[model samples]
Target: MDNRDAVSAFLRSRRERITPEQAGLPVYGQRRVPGLRRGEVAALAGVSVEYYTRLERGNLKGVSDSVLDALAQALRLDDTERMYLYDLARAAGPAPRARARQREVRPAVRPSVARIVEGMPELPAFVMNNRLDTLAANSLGRSLYSQMYADSTCGANVARFAFLEPAARRFYADWERMARFAVGALRIEAGKNPYDRELSNLIGELSTRSDDFRVMWGSHDVHVFRESTKRLNHPLVGVLELDQETLSLPDETGLSVVVYSAPPGTAAEDSLKLLASWSATTGQDQHTESASEPSDRHL
Candidate 1:
């Protein structure tokens, strides 16, 4: 995607969301526009109309940090939104550098990282990277996402599974909220690593294929997904309400482990214990049935 287009669209969208009343500008009468006029924003930002217009038109190269801050203040942008504005400016700047690209996930897993996941069998835990590739998962974690894991071709793509896959609609209890969180997380990831080729491709594909994804993506919203509460339906274990946390791996770039657990005495917690028991009994039954079955030669 062209950085200029991204910058322009993002700024325009943010600008359109605000009203003169919100910005403390008096709305004299019925206006032709939805948001503050160019001159009004410039005046509030302490910049000339021409300069502000240029910036909004995607000319952010060589812009001063102070001016960017002032513009951010004028727009009443939040911390994430302000950071996203700066990210776009830096990406569009003349002293250009390739943004971080997430191509293929590193093939080899860190042994210690795997061990940590294995140690937490009671907790559904897995590792993913900036590109939302699910790198590693414990047995319980795998079970928790059996709907996703059942498909061998899932290939660790969270966005695809979350939105494109039909099963996901039933799996996630709060589908709309999950979609928002997914798109917002992706936006944050893009700003953090503007040149991520894999991420860019995923975004492009989603934009082309899904109208819902396209609309949300165009909003330029960003959110850090460090923690969340999720409600999921598991075929074997039934529904579970889980709280999840994403923990960064200091030694690995763009890598984080996500773990989910339910509080004790909750229905979800009980369901997990029952699932464990059922899995053990199912394993034993399978083994016993295998013993009774005839071999190929006998057949």
Candidate 2:
């Protein structure tokens, strides 16, 4: 992906989303385009129209922090959006420096992290990378997301399961909202790590396969994961309203542990208990079947 195109699209998208009145600027008779005009944004940001146009054209290279801040304020960007703009600017530095940044090593799930996931027997917990690939999961986590695992085509990727698998539409009660959040989060990652080949490939796959993904991705929205409630329709346990928490690893490995839990004394909590029992039973059955199977020697 071209950094310039991304930078240009992001800035233009943000600018076009805001109206002149919203920016506290006086509106003239009839507007030729949506949102505030380039001159209006330039005036608001305390920059000349020509300079603002240059920046908007995707030449964020050598842009100062203060100028970025001014543009952020003029565009009424949220915290996440402002950070994205800064990331884009940082990426637009000297070619050699940007190339150095491009060579990233994929992080592995450390033994301690695996242990932490396994330690949570009662809760559904898993570790995922920036691309939402399920690196590891506890027994209950695997059971909770069995449908995603069943579809090998998804490659244990959350976004792929959501966009490519039809079952995901039913599994996630609020599919549209969840899908948008996923797209937005991926957009933020792209801005920060523009040259991530795996991430770019995943985005390309989703865009090609899912029309819904295309619309959401085109929105250029950004999101940072936080504690939220997710309603999942588990095939085994039925509907479960679980609280989701995402904890990022301190080592900056781009890996996050996601845990799901339900409040005590609620139906959702009861369902979780039933789901755990089912997982255990399923494991036992698989073990027994495997043990009883005839060996190749016998054949």
Candidate 3:
């Protein structure tokens, strides 16, 4: 997508989500649009209506930081969204060559990183790139995401499984909420790595195949996947409520380690133990099956 189109879409989406009352502006007349009018936004941002209209039309090439910040405030944008605006502006500038070089370098998890994941047998740990591709996972991690692994063609993308796979509805307790969060997180990644070919291809594929994905993508939402509480409905062990922590691998650029854990002496902890046991058994079965089928097929 062109930088102008992305910037315009993002600005319009943000503008369409804020009402006059929400922005502390008086409702003067019958509104044609759902949210703040262009004139109202321009007034709030201390800019002319024509200038704001130009910005909303995707002319962000020479936009100043003060102007962007004022626009962000006027739109009531969150931190992620504000940063995304900056990213869009930067992408519209003369940085395409640097971005292209970065995209050409594919990120990989180091052997030491894989060993770290393996060492965390008690916790469900996995390494993922910015695209949410599971580069490495422990046995428990693999078992926790069994549904995603069930479809070999889908690979190890969390976003793909959440949006494109029907089994996700059964796996995630709050499937719709998780789907939206996944898409938002993907959007944030896209903002950071605008030239990533794999990320773009994955997004294009999901947008084409999944209506839910397309809708979420159109929202222009962005989120940081730092830490959260996730509830999962495991097919073998029933429900599990786990605390998820995402740690960035400093040496690996776009790579991160995601670990799921439960507090001690809680029912969630017991469920995790049961899941570990089940994972062990499933691992053995998969090993036996590997002789006949492809060894790379996850359990």
Best by lDDT: 2
Residue pairs of candidate 1 with colliding backbone atoms: 99-195, 101-196
lDDT of 2 by residue, 1-299 (tens): 56898888888999899988899888769988998788888999999999999999999999999999999999999999999999899878867455546445667777788788888888988888777777777878878888887744222777888888888999999898888878988988888777777778789988998899998999999987663899999998899999999899998567888999999999999999999898887782121011111111100
Please identify which of the two predictions, 1 or 3, would achieve the higher lDDT against the true structure. Answer: 3
lDDT of 3: 0.80
Residue-by-residue lDDT tens digits, candidate 1, 1-299: 45777777777877888899899988787999878888988999999999999988988888989999999999898998898888877776543333333324353447778788767867877877666667677767767776666653222566767777788888889887788878988887776555666677788878887888898887787776645788999888778998888888888877788899898889999988776566555552111010111111100
TM-score of candidate 2 relative to the true fold = 0.91
- Candidate 2: C-alpha RMSD to true structure equals 6.1
lDDT of 3 by residue, 210-269 (tens): 998998899888877654899999988888999999888888877888899998898989
- lDDT of model 1, residue 176: 79
lDDT of each: 0.73, 0.81, 0.80
Best by TM-score: 2
Specify the poorest-scoring 10-residue window by lDDT in model 1.
Answer: 290-299
Residue 60, model 1: Cα distance from true site in angstroms = 2.0
**Model 3 TM-score, all chains together:** 0.90
Model 2 gets an lDDT of 0.81
